[model samples]
Target: MNKKGWWLMLLIAICGIQTVRAQGETPTDAKATPETLSLYKNLLKLQHEGMMFGHQDDLAYGIGWVYEEGRSDVKDACGDYPAVYGWELGHLELGDAYSLDSVHFDKIQGWIKTVYERGGVNTISWHLRNPLTGETSWDTSSKEVVRSILPGGEKHALFLTYLDRLADFLNQLKAEDGSFIPVLFRPFHEHTGSWFWWGKDLCTVDEYKALWRFIVDYLQKEKSIHHVLYTYSTDRFETEAEYFERYPGDDVVDILAFDLYDRGAGYSEALKYCASVVTAEAKKRSKIAAVSETGGPIAQNTEWWTKTVLPSLRPYDLSYVLVWRNPWQPASHGAFAPYKNSPDSEDFVRFYNDRKTLFQKEVSKLKLYE
Candidate 1:
């Protein structure tokens, strides 16, 4: 409250910034490419200030912000948006695209550019369908799918065509001022655990690494899609060795991140343990870290916003923590950002107001884009 106290706080902040800058490994603020230099550097600076809060489908939809249909829960509740917006490239990979989401491609591109120009961060995850079986990402029945999409396989060309489609889509993300919209493009996430076709048991370590390298190289080198920062993420890991077991090497990855969906594995304790692993590894690698995806039943636990979630992140200065989307169905309990009059709405307001948590309101003044 006093001038002396403010000076001390300022000194501590400067020292924090200097300590992280001095302990450099590669001086990457989490950039997958040179195009993301501004974003990378700003995230590094933010590591000294406060952690960012992200929301999956916050723009496309929320409890109120439905795709092509409704309003925004975040805007209505907190009078601002999320610092980071999470989206999916799944339907776009499928060609027709509209089969899954009411949100159209044109709309998505517009929103992405808006967020980028507004100084908000955008992180995209892919749930690409099984190229071999024409099935969804969750269908792992075909053991041969991973091999089919690799460089030497039969479906390899088809997969490249898919990449071309994705490239075309990403290239459209330009701000009104004509600058490319830099995005945190996360692909093949949660590979450390075996759930998807690209997971641990489905592909060998070398095969996974090769896949990642090829994807990043193809998109950048061949397609000229340079408005992206590649993020390498995995499911929860217990040890440092386990975390990097399938890493695609430091050359390709920008942000070292992971997903931790606490489905009854001791809740906050499990989250804290995994958070330590991600943040430490990011610092060691000189990359920014994030809780790429996480959420549980917040409706039942009212104080979840301020108590459980924020406390789990107190030990780490992560770039952002993106909770899962808030589906519009009446029976859903998985909404991460609270809607107006929802059970956790008031608690979420407290989370938004917390000095340690960075939201869109706070980000408006941070000048992250510059």
Candidate 2:
């Protein structure tokens, strides 16, 4: 009885492990909560249906509005909230009451819980100030910036303090039922460009990779934050090699994403090419793929959404495509999405009605965290 029983148990255990591996059910966070695991699987499944639409700072403020409850430019124009909601954590590292964009941390927290309870997705990106110079994230004044914040670097301790603040915010994103609200935590995004301190030219590839790994390790392991999924994103890239050049590794990245704004006539081709490459790579790795950030002023082309954005992304198996914000200041370049009665509003509505795009009404039916 002892010999046969033990051998059968061992064989069954091995088979179960193999089954999970074959199905690609393991998240990058080994200890990811059950709801987090469910969310990941649902995102992977949603890729086949359509890409979810996302808007940055959608509920915090919008064109001609500030902190108005239940207000969103996207909703005003299209009559639906975006399926994915994007938030920024730039000033949280400095213990600021408001984000760099001036949205209060408490408001952001409440909005995140609202989105989660409604079964929508939440993704947050950090634009923390450069640790070396205490300047904006765009301050690439020092090449040693990335190195300075790494494990043994001079500012490593300070970086941990920053991470601690971020962890505190994330750990508090809880629902009324006491379960953590899972979110896509995208840190150090757009690293392919030189504008940011951690950009490609600012840090060696190995250093960049190390930086990414250290963040994931510290947040998930040391800080005990298991409700987050790490996203690896680049600003723009022409080839798969460029996209993965500084990738942290499969074990630490749950999503493969990129951000591309309209740059001119080449935008469409570039979008199609990058989407194809990213989705294909994601398929190969069993990871989620997305256009994490995109959209530019559409004044020059009223049909931009339907003709350019939709067409280029319609063919890819991407989880979501997010446009930037519609700031209250009319002239700010931050207005990437159309506002109510804007020239491109009609086109945006068309883009939303398309079968290939998923907005709040559609995504709410997916039960992503169940």
lDDT of 1 by residue, 112-189 (tens): 877877789999888888899888887788777778888999899989988988999888887776667889989999
Candidate 2, residues 159-269: lDDT per residue as tens digits?
Answer: 999999999999999999899999998989999899999999999999999999998999888999999998999988987889999999999999999999997879899
In model 2, residue pairs whose N, Cα or C atoms come closer than 3 Å (at least 3 residues apart or on different chains), thus clashing, are: none
Using alpha carbons, what is the TM-score of model 2?
Answer: 0.93
Look at candidate 2 and tell me the lDDT of residue 215.
88
Question: What TM-score does structure 1 among the candidates reach?
Answer: 0.90
Please give the RMSD of candidate 2 to the true structure: 8.8
Candidate 2 local lDDT, residue 147: 93
Model 1's alpha-carbon lDDT is 0.77
